[model samples]
Target: MGETTTGLVPTTVRGEVEGQDLIMWEQLTDAARSGLTNAGFAAPIIDEAFMPNLESARPSF
Candidate 1:
């Protein structure tokens, strides 16, 4: 059987995850981290540059 994959690849002209995408990104990453832990895998090390800014109030989380 083929393997199942779950992931997100955000596309933006400004090269940033904002608005609805930003919220989804946060949720997806959180879920992924939890899932990885439950699966006995090391959590991913996310770079700050790749993450959205929590200070900016563009879209509510």
Candidate 2:
């Protein structure tokens, strides 16, 4: 339902299955072992680092 049938690329991008994005992103980053040291650099390197701001974001509900 989240894909298109007609386009220049002629492709169907299956929509993410529920929370699969978060799960997949986390899975991809699982190889890294983060710690107190260099914590500042760990997140930016991954680019999926939005956890801290997410909690404070305005509640849309």
Candidate 3:
């Protein structure tokens, strides 16, 4: 063993990485939210928006 490294690196470095990951996730989430909204699927009322239309299209006896 020449020089065994030990102990945690640093909280600030780990925090920066976590912050970057959050930023990346936010960007991706925003893009996906926009795509869904454009496609007429509101995030909050997704099922409410499509379920009624689907139900109406079913063969009624």
For all candidates in order, the CA lDDT equals 0.51, 0.46, 0.57
- Per-model RMSD to reference: 13.7, 10.4, 15.9
Candidate 1 lDDT over 1-61, as tens digits, reads: 3443545554556847565534444556777767644673333334442255444536766
21-58: candidate 2 lDDT, tens digit per residue: 34443454434444432377433433354665665675
Q: What's the C-alpha lDDT at position 10 in model 2?
A: 36
Predicted candidate 3 versus true structure: per-residue lDDT over 1-61, tens digit per residue:
2443452244544535543233443566777867766685233446566787778779989
C-alpha displacement of 34 in model 1, angstroms? Answer: 0.3
- Candidate 2 is scored at a TM of 0.17
TM per candidate: 0.20, 0.17, 0.31
List the lowest-lDDT window of 10 residues for candidate 3.
1-10
Which stretches of model 3 miss by more than 4 angstroms? 1-27, 38-46
- Candidate 3 — number of clashing residue pairs? 0
- The candidates, ranked best first by TM-score, are 3, 1, 2
Candidate number with greatest TM-score: 3
